[model samples]
Structure formats: structure tokens, C-alpha cells
Target: MSLLLERHGQCLCGAVQLDCRLDNSDVSACHCQTCRRWGGGPLLAVECAQPPVIGGGDALGIHASSDWAERGFCIHCGTHLFYRLKAEPHYAIPVGLLEGEDWSLASEVFIEEKPAWYCFANQTRQLTGAELFAEHGQPDDA
Candidate 1:
């Protein structure tokens, strides 16, 4: 499929809308408990260098999920919109948000913290939190 030049997404109640452009397809499935609790599964996300052009920005609620991460959602509908890196200025939008297409990006970043009851059958690279952080800089203590 064509790389997204512009993508459109909206919240559950349509109270928040976003338009964005992304170049990379490096998506990941985050299994951290925080992520699983927030989205009810591994969060499938893709990266965007620039913030999406948002409409009804007033309806969005942001929570600092960690020292460097924040979660954004619709206050009215409680739809998770995106997760952002507080220091990096980049964002990971839920793959479900891209209006009308099925796009498979890079699938990695699974935290071993995932419950044994669930297993990802996809042939994607699987890494625990420590592995992911080690690949970046230090090992994850979480």
C-alpha cells in the first residue's frame, strides 16, 4: 500500500479528529502492563515525526504515562488516540486509527511481561522490556 501521505482518524464519539503524515512503517506491539491495561492488548502503533493536525483538540486528554511518555485520548469518548514520547517529540498512533486501509508495519517491542494466557502468533520479532531498552541505551529496570 502507498505510504501514508495523509491519514485521518477520529475518536469514538467523533469528538476529536486528526490528520497526519508518516514516513516510517516501524510499528510495535507494546505488552507493558500499562499499555495492555490502557488498550486491552498489545498497542499496535506506528511512528509519526510530526504531530497530527488535530481538530477539536479541546476534547483530548493527556496523561503522563511515564517519565518520558504520555498517552492521549478523547475525554468525551475515552478513545485512545496516540502515545507520545515526552522528550522525543514523536508519536505512535494506533494502527486502527488510519481510516481505510490495513497497513502492516514493523512489528516488534513485545514486553515479556505479557500474560501467559495470551500469545502473539504473528511472526514478528519479540523482545522484553529489558531487551528493548538495552538496544536503545540502558537495560530496563521495569
Candidate 2:
């Protein structure tokens, strides 16, 4: 996607809407425990350089899952919104939320934590938990 391309999306209930520019068309999957528990599987998302413009502020909820990161969701519909790094302006938004956009899997993180019951057919770079922390900086506890 071009840097100038903007996308719009909303939660299941349409109580919250997002407007943001696409930093790339490549999507990444996170199989970390937190992500899996949050969404029932891996989180397939695209990183946005800037936080999306959030509509219906009152319908948005944020949970600080770790000292260095937080998860956002729609309060009304409980739709996972994004995973945000506390020290940065970036956001990893769920690809499913960006309706009508085609995103290709580029990578997968926390590969070691992924369950064996399911797997992706995509051939993408995979990173273990240790590698993810090393590359992105560990959470406070790490």
C-alpha cells in the first residue's frame, strides 16, 4: 500500500470507527499467549506508524497488558482494536478490521508459543519469543 493510502474501518457493532494511513500491505501474525487468549488464535495485523484516528472515544477501551504495551478494543462489541507499544506512536491493527483490504502475511512472531492444532499455509519469516524480544526490545519483565 502507498503511504498516502488511507483506510477506514469499524467494530462489529459499528460503535467505533478508525481512520488511518497504511504503512504497508504486509501483515504479521503474533502467536504470543496474550494475543491468543485475547482473540482465540493468532493476531494477524499490520503495523501503522501512527495511531489511527479513533471515533466514539467512549466506546473504546484500553488494557495495559504489559508495561511496554497495551491492547485496545471496542467496549460495546469487545472487538480487538490494536496492539500499541507504550513508548511509540505505532499500532498493530487487526487485518480483519480493515475491511476490503488485501494483506499478505509477511511474518509470524512468538512462533514457539503457537499451538500445533492449527498452522498457516503462508510461507513467511518466523520468529521465536526470544528473537521477538531481542528485535523489538523486551517487555519490562524480560
Please estimate how well model 2 matches the true structure, expressed as its whole-model Cα lDDT: 0.87
Which lDDT tens digits does candidate 2 get at residues 54-95? 999999999999888899999999999989988768799998
What CA RMSD would candidate 2 show? 1.9
Note each model's CA RMSD in angstroms. 2.7, 1.9
Q: Tell me how far the alpha carbon of residue 18 in candidate 1 is from the true structure, in angstroms, after superposition.
A: 1.3
Poorly placed runs, candidate 1 (over 4 Å): 1-4, 134-139
lDDT on C-alpha atoms for all candidate structures: 0.79, 0.87
Model number with the top lDDT = 2
Residue pairs in candidate 2 whose N, alpha carbon or C atoms collide under 3 angstroms:
none
